[model samples]
Target chain A: MWLDILDRGYRPGTKLLFALIRLLSGQPLPDAAKVVFYRPDFYGTRAKEFTHEAMRGPSAWSVGDRELMAAYVSQVNECAFCVGAHTATARQACHDASRVAAVLTDLDSAPIEEPLRATLRMLGRLTREGKAGAEDMRQVLAAGASPEQVKDALAVCAAFNVTNRLADAFGFERLTPQGYEAGARHLLKRGYR
Target chain B: MTGGHLPPVANKTEGIVPDEDDKQAAFRALADRVLNGEGQASARQRAGAFRNHGLAPPLAALIGKVADRPAQVTREDLAAARASGCTEDQLFELVICAAVGHSARLYEAGLSALAEATGEGSPGHVA
Candidate 1:
């Protein structure tokens, strides 16, 4: 009762963010409370709609770059939670899950193209060493990424750190393997994979 | 690098997401009763039994009535799942389908943050 009240006293600000987030994610507020709320960001779309945009925003920069960076960060956290979750999400994004799996598991033989692979290697160092520099990305640019792509790569890598930490710190409730598979499966059909 | 014959990125990769109608109905139900119907610590206790066990000492078996089952869920079942390292919400969120669109964005953003967190947060999966 106490937590429920605390959860429901929806005044606004960050609480609104979580409420909108939860609402958009499809698990809306419970029935009695759903409608009584003054204002909620329903987004007039399914949970996946908001997520699709959030997930793809990085690609406005580069494809393999974002997926690779997300996967890389999840792996860094050793978050059995986020690592597995994002691996599935990465699968939906079009990069081979096999490569993500291999990379996540600590293998160097990922199937990403040479340039992308170079980028991943650099990301690996950056994630492990604290930060990256212009020289760290020289190979990335040489491999084919532009200055913009280089910038986005860093952003994607940084974003993964934030998400992975959130998932790990909170001890994210997990889905069955079947559940994980279904996530990618659904995205594939809907076109956001 | 520019034109690496990487597989052409297509939007769709796999399954039939529920229709918008189903999704909306589900959202309404979700917002109203689903999450509130249960308790977090309670749900987590059963689901997190394995994790708790990983940290707690064992106790002798006791003869008693089985733990009461929630309207549909039972404690024993949750304990069993937890012992196997299962989780509840995030897993389900990862699986639920969205409308057929934005196929390209499935696991996109968040990389930068993840990497940053890994390095700053913990020793694993950082880069």
Candidate 2:
């Protein structure tokens, strides 16, 4: 069931969603074809470039790390779109199957190092509590993650939140569990999420 | 929640008749998602709208809810954004604006995590 989703084709609504993800992630709805379900009206047009970039490239932090961050954060938020998207990417990156499984099944065991852990933890706390402490970012920086890395991680968290909500909110065009895994692989191989 | 709705945000200008079962099933799933996952009023609103209008449920309705937290690290998405040239401040605005601005609960979590992990007295705690 999960793997089958990988082979499914896109439809109009799904395309719109694709566009929305792109637009929200910073891609533009201006891009045509099936990927426009998200709509710039919701995610805005400004995020286009940023979203486009997420599709491929190395990380200011680490592409593998970024994918994992997204996967963890998305799971924290309980977003299927994000979970599927990031999970697919994570698998492809294949940093560590055990670590990946840990993050997927037990978030407490995420494989990344400190500063990032602090950031993700903070993000999770905020999601649970609705307001993080001032020190979370500080701790992240202290751990050697730059202010920039901290903030970008924030973007990953934020984007995933919106993306997850949107995906879950619609609850359609879902990928199968297998496809979810493959999708992450596609992103990782392509270097985007 | 109802299955289908006309979409309070939309007009009757361009759309479909809507599959009742699909919309209903999707809404039920979405409602479950909010209850079991993140608690967002908008999602509830959508669910309510679904019930109100009688739309069909979506496919996301079938899967079990995902756990709400994580404790591992495996990707470098953050580093990539930085490499994309987003400064700390930009990243800050981008994240906060994106998360909170987009979803209240998610926003709260994003901020809280930052504070807890980076806030004072938490050195090496995250590691």
Candidate 3:
């Protein structure tokens, strides 16, 4: 939205990739993807790696949890683009889409376990305050999350903290509900690679 | 080498496996390069402008405002940065660097908290 380097101005490789994305999804590539595609070699590659490792990697936390965490961070950051995209992904990954709505409404009272809620709370604090101390970790642990789970969840939170800023800073365009669902499906199938 | 006490360790990765330690080191190195490396926007003063680490002036202002109060980022800000000769790609890279820096801070804080909770010698202490 801010910059003009969309499909027309992008490099040949990025333009080709965008064509593929459109072909596969039947919709234009979102601005979030465009920002990464603008810099395919350095920042884009690293961003993709971090996203895959944090959101799609093997972990005790389910994909739904990671996506929800990402959505929550974006919501807190007021990034509509990411909130839409990841909220859809979370809905797709979970059995009940209402849980995603509940989390967006109020994570503390959402119909989820205490451990996951605690993790979300910590991530919320991290997003707003940029710090989560030892007490936060102890709280998640007390709520029954293991160390590995905490690490994975924190990685998700951290990655989203980065991505939410990117989305806002670059002025990513808002997607329709259907568009978000389609983007989620693409991510679930193809991943960030 | 003599069978004697090791010298006082200075670097944090002295005892960790080289692969694991190098991975973290490489990430840190890359982050440093992104933020501090010479480029079109490198000549601008970065320190203390917006609580960001070593970003150009206009870029630090934009990224800092985006991170804290994104609503305040106006067309004037964008115009100023563009007028100051920052290319769109440079601005994009700066945003990514700033976001990654923010994430790294949170990640370090979370890991430190985990280390403290698990005690210094525990398995999760140094992640």
- Write down the worst ten-residue block by lDDT for model 3 chain B: B1-10
- Summarize candidate 3's per-residue lDDT along A18-96 as a digit string, tens digits: 8997888888888877766664554666667767777777788888888888899889888788999998999998867
Score every model by TM-score: 0.43, 0.49, 0.84
User: How many clashes does the backbone of model 2 have?
Assistant: 97
lDDT of 1 by residue, A69-162 (tens): 6667657646455565567767766656677676666646765666666666776666555445445556666677654454445545544443
> Candidate 2: lDDT of B118?
41
How does model 3 do on interface RMSD, in angstroms?
A: 2.8
Model 1 local distance difference test score: 0.39
Highest-DockQ candidate: 3
Say which prediction, candidate 1 or candidate 2, comes out ahead on DockQ. Answer: 2
Q: i-RMS values of the candidates, in order?
A: 14.1, 14.0, 2.8
The predictions' CA RMSDs to the true structure, in order, are 17.0, 16.7, 5.8
Error of 2 at A118 (Å): 2.1
lDDT of 2: 0.43
Candidate with maximal TM-score = 3
* lDDT of model number 3: 0.69
Sequence-dependent TM-score of model 3: 0.84
